[model samples]
Target chain A: MSIKKVLTGNHAVSYGAMASRVQVISAYPITPQTQVVELLSELVADGKLDAIFVNVESEHSAMSACISASAAGARAFTATSAQGLALMHEMLHWAAGARLPIVLADINRAMAPPWTIWTDQNDSLSQRDTGWMQIYVESNQEAFDSIILAYKVAEQVFLPCMVVLDAFVLSHTSEPIEIHDQEKIDEYLPPYRPMVTIEPGKPIGYGALAAPDTYMEFRYKMQRAMENAVEIFEKEGKLFGDMFGHSYDLVEPYMMDDAEYVIITVGAVTSTARVAIQELRKKGEKAGLLKFRVLRPFPFEKLRELLSGRKKVAVIDRNISFGHHGIFYQEVKSALYPLSNRPPVFGYIAGLGGRDITVSDVVDIYEDMKKRETLEEIIWKGVKL
Target chain B: MVEIRTHGRGGQGAVVASKILADAAFRVGKYAQSFPQFGVERRGAPVVAFTRIAESEEELPVRSNIYEPDHIVVLDPTLLSIPDTFAGLKEGGWVIVNTPELPENLDIPAKFRVATVDASEIAVKYGLGSKAQPIVNTAILGAFSRVLENVIPLSAILNSIPEEVPVKPDANQKACEEAYNMTRIRK
Candidate 1:
């Protein structure tokens, strides 16, 4: 039986990690992400979760510790936010290149020079090239379930997974979610049994030195594992749905079957866009939403399949790639580029530094997409200037 | 769906009050969500929190701050001086304020229903917080349940107090009940 509880997105991640029976948690406290590890530490101290809660000095050390723990054959986990995530940049590469299946919950906080602690996608989107499979979630429930699913898929592919949630919007927001029973979760996700581990007295070397003769092979294998993860994610997602009744996918399409104009979104913005789509549909506008759940592995084929003949496509990105289009906008346009009859993909940047994107704003974007005959470099929404 | 926004200073349990309202709503089999907007982490600074209750999860799909609220709860009466306090409030909405003065004495617009309770005095009477800054959140919520009875029941708020307020749960509950009885409304 599943239990329902009102939980903050941060606490949901904590409960999810605990239910997954994570053996090692090493994370430093960061705004909008601290509550995640705070609850985990208490659970470990109270004996509810039998795990080692390592106290790390910084985000870099946090990821480093997770790397060491996973190397020693433990189900490792950590949580961090914008600057902390940025600090873990080098170690993120290290964890992925070493083929340790570590799971991280990155509360999406905007990178600071102005020093703000608000929700944005730039933080996690900046790490797109670090070889970590990133899954941006829409709600607190998905944030919790993704932890277990992340581990199931990551361990199989030997690549790290980053479960991303909007800071404050989801991180601090409280919502009622169905908490799965431990036994059922355990049945769904078996123990992480890595093919290699650093055992005592075994004296096996790891990450020694890959010469040019073999350096390319490791990259090739990692690429193959990533490719393999696409199928594994689909299978595990379906199986999780069969067990828990909530199914997930690389992309979730809403009202898109006959949608003439489609709006693409990621993270919490998808929820707002969903409301916009419903309102638009009621008004006789065939608007639709395609929510991107899995950022990594790109799902280019799925994008092409879903968006091939749409009249117009609008991609709302909370993160901007300076001097260029929105990050997701670039990805969507690139994905549809190969199609001979692909509709025009409009790029929009909105809700950066934690601005609230209202449903009406989304409707405006749909209207803007309809009026535009050519692509603009970037369509700025909700900008004061 | 009913949307509520709470205004208070830091250390006044505004955020906790939002969560407790959501928890109370959840206890009664409603889909609820609560969150806060914090400018800074210092006491005496203004803070705002939001609670949303709906018949089902699908009714609460917009994951953004509540702009237009059906009701507003003022834990600190001084917050009323700020224009943002009553911004975008719907006509005929409830304005539940924690003040000793009756609803007629308050300076709010007449279009909205006003309910006033001396929550600060009641909270101190129960020794919930310091006399200087008594935690009036529970009392305000108690008044909320009474004035907005159709939205949430007092019994549900009473049941949720212990679960949400770990320290001096009895005191908070007593303050809540007292404010519920003492609240004066101008419909």
Candidate 2:
């Protein structure tokens, strides 16, 4: 039985934590993510939620608190954004390397060059090197579902998970999200049965320095677990589909089966792209949208299959890769680098620093895709020519 | 899916208000989400957070700003004049603002449902604080409870406030209960 009420993306995350019956939560007060901690604290205080809400001083300490709690066999959660996320950089790798199945909601805020705290993918996207499973959600419901699924996926794969919801755009925006039943969730996810436990009786040493000879194997094992998570994500997606009657894939295609020119994007831009494609189709352009939900795995094989026959493909990236192009677009072009019937890949950078990317931007990308006779390695959108 | 937007500054607990609303909704068995839209603005910078509660599937591909909101809860009345805050507000949608009196000087679209309360004054009166940053979120919520049908029960929201925070459990809860009984709604 779902109730009808209005809630923001941050609240949805708290609801997700509550539904997951999160054992421990700790987060510092950052602009976009502060609400998440504020609400969680209230829930813990009111007895609406049964969890230990740690009052941490900074985002770094917050993640540290969650990591320690998770290592102690608790389902730990936390939230952060932008500089706060950057502060957690070293520990992010540490948490994943230690194989603590902690789930965090990173309210995606742009790092300051010009001192802006608006929405952008750079903060989390830049952390791709960290051995964590990352998922960018497009809507409020996805934010809720992603957190719940993240715990299950991380625990199953023995890795940490970061669920990225674009700060302000998705984070502050309100939308309806279906909250799962506690009984249903418990049925789906049993109590936290940690594969690795640290107890006084057992006395396990975590984060111990390894010898040079054995460090490679530890790193190799972490990589292996990430590879394993691809399968785990699919399995969990299947189970969530079975329980909720809605299915989400690593990649979601919108009218792309017959698309001659496909526009690839991530996050909320995909929604605007979908609307743009619909309007474009009415005008007889074979435009389509491929929403990349799973960014960390970099669905190379799927991209190859979809890009094989397209005349021109454009990648709309919200986060830049400095000298090259959009991070996801660079990965997409690389994925198609080995294909025989590879389409000409064009990458466009838009919506940086939380600047609103409207449907017009999507149309501009599709229109560029249609007009290009030869492909350039990259094309920047929303840039002054 | 009904979209909701909240307007306040960074220190105002606008974000907490959304989450408490979400918690109450979830308690009654509804799907809810809350998030904050903030910029470089610190304590005094205007911030907006949102909430969406619905009975069915939440459509993906959301926008940053709330267009056609079913409800808009403004924690700071000053924000009303600073921007086109109500530019896309839906006709007949509810607007619960924390103001002493409905600003008669401003051009308010006629079709909107309006409710006003001096939440800051109430907060001070109840010993919330001289600044009254935290209590407004709860007072507006309690007033919202009275004005918006099915928003949340006062008991549920009161129950949702933490017993630990002296401001929330004692003064904040009293502020909400008082605002709930006192606020007048003009449709």
Candidate 3:
């Protein structure tokens, strides 16, 4: 039997890491994400978790410690928010390039100049090309489940994974979730066994300078590993569901069986959209929602198949690409570009800097999508000009 | 579905009170969700928290902040003067306050039922906090259980205190029980 507890999203992440039996944890304190490491440290100190809790002065050092730990054949984990994530930018690429399957929980906080501790996707979106697999979660339960899944998938594909959730929204929100039996989790996720490790007296250079002759091949191998992750994620997800009864995929489709109008969303916004779609259905509107769970290893074929032949589609992005359109908007349009029957994908930028996206606001977007004759390049919602 | 908005000062356990309510609701086999106002909190500054309870998880899927709450809990009586404290409260809802004054004498609209308790005195008597700034969150929740008895039982609230109230579990439970018995309601 699974243990049930009311946990904040941050604590849920900690429990996820603990359940995975992470061998090493190193982190710096940051808003919204602080409670995550705080709980982990307490667990470690209280002897609940037998792991090395490395106290670091900076996020860069924190990631560095995780990289070193994972390189030495240990399961390593860390959690951080906006600026802290940005500070660890260089080391993020290093971890991925080294093919260490370290799991990092990034609470999505907006990049700040005005100094705000609110939710937004800009911080994580900016790290799109770092070669780390990103999974955005909707609920606190998913936040916990995804971490275990991340380690399972990452360890197999030899790629680092970042489990992302909305700052404050998911991070601070408390909800009921099932904490799976440790023996069951252990049965699913065995101890981490690396093919090679930095052992004493075994002189092997790590991340050595790749000459021009072999640099392209290393990049090619990384790309191949990413391609392999797509299938690995599916297989592990199915296996996990068979064991624990909560299966997940790259994307979650809601009310899309015969939906002519679809809304594409990511992260916590999908929860609100689910409610809005139910309300829309009650009023006899054929509205559906497809939540993008995985950002990296973009589900191109999946998007094309789900969005093909739709009358109209709207992509709601909480993160902007500044000069261009919303980040997910660009990805969706790109995915549908090759489809023979591509729908008009409208881009909407909404709920930046922790602005609440109410059910009414979502319904309004659907109404706006239906009323428009021609598609606008970008539509701004809930923004004061 | 029952939505509750809690108003309190920063130093007060407003967020913890919200969590405790959610935990109590969950103890009775109900789905619960709670969160605080997404802002930097400063001591003595006004803070708000929300708790949502429903029969199923689907009913509480919407993650946005609570706009129109079914009821309101005020931890600090001074916060009652702030218009935003009652901004989106539903009509004919319960207004549970922590004040020494009687519910009938308190300045609240007659449309809503008011329940008042001297939670400060109860908390202080139990030594939950200090004489000047007593941590009245547990006591207020006790009064909440009394006023909204049908929503969540007093036993669940009493049972949830030991796990949630970290500082002084026994004292907090006693304060809650006292406030539950001492609460005065003007309906």
Candidate 4:
């Protein structure tokens, strides 16, 4: 039997973690992400969940506790947002390179300069080379489901994974999400069996200092794990789908068949794009959407196939690389660079902070894609110039 | 889809009001979504909350904040004097305000369908106030349900009251019922 409840995306993630039977949780509170840790703490205190709630002074210590618990062969979890995530920068690399299967929830909030707490992808996108797998979610259900699936993939690849949700958009919004049966989840995900442990019984030295020769091999091995992770991601996704009657892929195609124009977006924007695409199609225009599911593996091959057929592919990003264009647009262009017959890729940046991006904006994007050809590097749509 | 924008001061249960309305919609088999705009706001500071009710979960997929709302609920009528409170309000939309005065005392637009209720009096009667400030969120919802064309059953709101408001659930239910019965609608 499935349990259905109205929950914010943060609470959905918390429910997912509890259902996954996380053994240890240590996190410092942050805006939008505070509810996640707060609810988890409640569950622990209520005796509804069996987990060790570690009190930490800062995000750095929270991650360190996660690292220690994971290294000791336990399923550890933590959550943070914006500056809090930045504070865990050092531990992020240590967890991934150490090959510990720790799962984290990063509520994607904008970085502070003038000091604003709002939704944006820049925070997580800036950590592109952190060696942790990043999976962005669109809804509360996706946030709940992805965290569980992420743990399975992380454990298999021996790499840490971060399940990301947009700051206030997903993190604070409440939606009806179905909670999976604990027995079914138990059947799907077994207890963690570490391939590595720092126990006296094993009698092995861990994290020894390495010179150039040994350091290169360890780095190469980490790359190899990331490569395998791309495949393991799909495998676990399929496994979860079969059990839950829902499936997720790296690229979700919406009415893309025989479409001449496509709008590419990540996270919740894709849902609005779908509505606009349908509206365009009603007016006798061929328009579709591609929602990027996983950012870590990048899904370059699938991206090539999806973009090859369309005449124009417009990339809408909520993040920028400062001086350059949008981060996802740059990646899309690089992915299609080597293709002999690739469609034209246009970039549009909009809805930074918590600004609203309505269906009309998407309709405007499709109209722009139809009218423009070879032109500017990027169009700053909806931004006051 | 029916979009609602709620206006109130901090510590007035405005955010919790949105959540309860959304939960009530869910109990009645309608897809519901709700959220509050978070910032640094203390007591008596203005805050906004939003709720979306749709026939299907997929119908309410947009995550953007609602601007042109189909309905507006004002937990505090003091927001009426602010010029920006009525921005992006859809023409012919309903406006439910918690005030005891007749329609002449309100600065209500001629185009809006107005509903008025003495939520403060109900809150006072129930003793659900903190010192000088009385929380009228639940009481206003009572008026909202009566004026909302019965989109959701009153029982749903009654059932959600105890779960959402921990203090004085029975008294809050009484206040809500009293407001629902006494609400005056002027189209």
TM-score, per-candidate, Cα-based: 0.99, 0.76, 0.99, 0.97
Question: Which portions of model 2 show Cα errors greater than 4 Å?
Answer: A1-4, B1-187
DockQ of each: 0.88, 0.28, 0.90, 0.72
Query: What TM-score does prediction 1 earn?
Result: 0.99
| Tens-place lDDT digits, model 4, residues A1-385 | 7888888999999999998899999999998799999999999999999999999999999999999999999999999998999999999989988899899999998889868888888888887798999998889999999988988888888999999998878888888999998899998888999987877677776677999879999989988898888888888888889999788888888898878988999998887788888889999998889999898877888889888857888999988888999999999899999898888888999888867788999999889977996755588888886
lDDT of 1 by residue, A1-385 (tens): 7899999999999999998999999999999899999999999999999999999899999999999999999999999999999999999999999999999999999999999999898999899998999999999999999999999999999999999999999999999998998899999999999989998999888788989999999999988999889989999999999999999999989999999999999999899999999999999999999998998977888889999999999999999999888999999988888899899989999999999999999999999999998878599999998
Q: In model 4, what is chain B's TM-score?
A: 0.96
Residue-pair clashes per prediction, in order, are 0, 19, 0, 0
For DockQ, candidate 2 versus 4, the one ahead is 4
What is the C-alpha lDDT profile of model 3 across B60-155, one tens digit per residue?
898999999999999999989999999988999999999999999888998888999999999889987778878989999999999787888999
lDDT of 1 by residue, B1-187 (tens): 9999999999888999999999999999899999998565779899999999999988998888899999999999999999999999999999999998989998999899999999999988999889998988999998999988778999999998998899999889888999899989885
User: Per-residue lDDT for A309 in model 1?
Assistant: 92
Chain A TM-scores, candidates in order: 0.99, 0.97, 0.99, 0.97
The DockQ score of candidate 4 comes to 0.72
Question: Which residue pairs collide, candidate 1?
Answer: none
List ranges where model 1 is wrong by over 4 Å: none
lDDT of 2 at B169: 78
How do the candidates rank by DockQ, highest first? 3, 1, 4, 2
Model 4: per-residue Cα lDDT over B50-135, one tens digit each: 99999897788877778888888888889988876787889888888988886566778898888899899899889989636999
User: Please, what is the whole-model Cα lDDT of each candidate in the order they appear?
Assistant: 0.93, 0.80, 0.93, 0.88
Looking at model 1 chain B, which ten-residue stretch has the lowest summed lDDT? B37-46
lDDT per residue as tens, model 3, A200-255:
88878889999999999989999999988888888888898999998988877999
